[model samples]
Target: MTTEEQTAVHAAMVAAGADRRPGGRTRTFHALLEGWGVEVAGVEEGYAWCGPEFDNDISCRSTLADVWPLLPPRVRSARQPRLDELDERFRAATIEWPGRGDEEQWWMWRIPRLLVIEPGDPYEGGWPAGWTMMPFPKPDSVRVIT
Candidate 1:
């Protein structure tokens, strides 16, 4: 992950209030990222896409806010700056998919998605291998990768 991207993921993790411990779910997610060459230091129920010069973290089970109460008061306070930093760095990537807000997302594993890169950030390796490619309305839109 690039420095900016790493910061974004770390910030997002803090913001999501993800529990810092590794469990079965976290291990599964970590292995997946590792196979993709993404450096994963922590594991949780969510998945992260981090690689050399690549930056993005996606969580399916939790976001910082979802698990806020689970975090210690000190940790919560420390995360404010990271959260604040993320507000400016990250932007929602519009994705056209069925049941965005509903529980019926076509790609069930992509929930709690986070796009660490900006709208115009240059990315290489384009969605990794085996990702279903579809035309997106805009560069800022999230493409459905089956």
Candidate 2:
């Protein structure tokens, strides 16, 4: 990973509230990535750790898919099996969500339903229609409602 990418990863980790001291979340995630033959210092591993922490389960999968093209062929080959296993597990655990309207189908982990709201909608107060909002960081484009 380039210095900029590594810095981004670290920043993401901090933004996600990961403990970065010894025996912290960063170390644990790096250890798991290392076992998958990913370089512990690489952007791939850093992103693999930060994505899920900073966002959600599907975000992790999507982030890895986004980064896959940047990996070398040999690294891709080495990581494919593990990634496939994770994909299978995620698929097995996921269920289709129909709450986000008919035009957009979202598949999420088999937990309580979550709502994702885009920006520019008017808001007044007290849980839009009584759905409790989760305390997630809202980016400029979207807010995750859990």
Candidate 3:
């Protein structure tokens, strides 16, 4: 990732209150998410470390929105339309951006699929109806200070 992108991720970590001690960081981070109306399905090993239950289940689109400006110019340009396409399908759906790739293309978009909804391939086969995929920095792409 570019230096600016890295900075953006770090800034997000701080904004999420992840700058605290290990135990507190998780608490503080989750609290931050709660303040933003994000539903915590469970913490998982992924880009943000916290996996949101659904697109609208969490109102974290704004939180993830913070990282957009810092992405490489080409990536930002390419990803915007993909985001729009998914949003059109699922109104008010939160984006679960998986992060950018080393190559020129962007990949990995997701939203948690609750039992109420059917699960399917995130790509190729297409997501289940009412599902929306958002964007987020990759886990390995950003150096988040824990």
Best-to-worst ranking by lDDT: 3, 2, 1
lDDT (tens digit, per residue) of candidate 1 on 31-106: 3323322222222112233332122343322343354444445555665575444332222222323334344322
Greater lDDT among 2 and 3 belongs to 3
Candidate 1 off by > 4 Å = 1-56, 60-63, 92-146
Q: Please give, for residues 44-115, the per-residue lDDT of candidate 3 as tens digits.
A: 121232333433333444443554454456555765775555444332222334442332222124433222
**Any residue pairs clashing in model 1, and if so which?**
1-51, 15-64, 16-63, 16-64, 17-64, 38-50
Listed per model in order, the count of residue pairs whose N, CA or C atoms clash below 3 Å is: 6, 0, 5
Q: After superposition, how far is residue 121 of candidate 1 from its true place, in Å?
A: 19
| Global lDDT of each candidate | 0.35, 0.38, 0.38
Top model number, TM-score = 2
On residues 5-92, what C-alpha lDDT tens digit does candidate 2 reach at each position? 5555445445544425345535322333333333211222222222233234344444454445554455567767887765444334
* TM value for model 2: 0.35
Best-first order by TM-score: 2, 1, 3
Evaluate residue 119 in candidate 3 and report its C-alpha lDDT on the 0 to 100 scale: 34
Instruction: Give the residue spans of candidate 3 off by over 4 A.
Output: 12-56, 69-75, 92-146
